[model samples]
Target: MESGFGTRRRTRLFDDLLALFLAEGFSQFTLDDIAAALHCSKSTLYTLAASKDDLVRRVTVHFFKRATAAVETTLSRNDDPRERVAAYLTAVGAELAVASEVFMADLNAFPPAREVYEANTAAAATRVRQLIEEGVDAGAFRAVNASFAGDLIATMMVRIQQRDVGKATGLSDAEAYTELATLLTNGLRT
Candidate 1:
């Protein structure tokens, strides 16, 4: 097993790399850039990560782990499926709103990162479908095609968040959640 100091050092390096990646698109930066940004040498980075691709994978995994935790926290706050769905979307929107432009640009630049994002999208869609199914079973939502509707709504919400539509509409994250919840609930209501 790695020593505690080694683990801390690795964590710090990863955090620094993540911050840099979020600030500068992955493709825009070279190994030298990362090394210079972190005040370290290229050899040190090589020692820490096998290659740039490995670094990207590590960063993507780190991001997803943190995001998944946030989603779980939001889900835990409510027992009602409808409320859980709203909370989840709101959390997602907040995340997108705060995401750096560089991060979005970098995501587009990296094909592997894009693939990872797609996988996450599918997973999120499954979660949304489950919530919708639960709501339907509880008579909290209408009798509709839960899977299809869930995917559609999830996609739309992602687009809206990415576009920062809430800012244009002069709505806070909470307001956006309420509006989205209203829309979904109405569409699914008996």
Candidate 2:
């Protein structure tokens, strides 16, 4: 059985690992490099994941899970449909702003990590769909096909996540999300 202190240490180490990955992409780090960077032993790092790729995937999951919770918390604070939609998008952007461009590029390049992002994007798209439906129901938005709009937004979001929008428009992911929120809210307004 693990002691409470052991659990806390592991949690702190995981937090540190995530911070490091967010600041500097994980693509270039070896197990030894990671241990050195985190001031932990190789065996200690192994406790987190069996391999570097596994650790990367785990950290990616942690990042998205935390971001999702924060976005939901932000959304809960707003009552108006328009504001709720805007808050959701803005909150997503805020959470993503912590990730460096290098980290994003690395994430896109890694298939396992990319899958996690794709799953989160799909979930977020569904959420946006529901928000649009709510707005239309509440008479705050124009009567349009909510599913279509949501699908369109999902496509744009995937493009943004894939770095295609960044390549084409010179807009960072966070900036692109902000633009999306503005355009979506304004277009939906009655």
Give a tens-digit lDDT track for model 1, residues 1-190.
8899988987888878877776665777788888889999988788777988877877777776667688778788889765767777666655544446667656755777766766765677688788889888988877878878887877755554343654478664435656776677667766
Worst 10 residues of 2 by lDDT: 81-90
- TM-score for all predictions? 0.79, 0.96
Give each model's whole-structure lDDT. 0.71, 0.93
Query: Model 1: how far is 124 from its true place, Å?
Result: 0.6
Please provide, for model 2 over 1-190, each residue's C-alpha lDDT reduced to its tens digit, 9 standing for 90 to 100: 8899998997788889899999999999999999999998999989989999999999999899999999999999899987888889989999999999889999999999999999999999999999999999999999989999999999999999999999999998989899999999998999
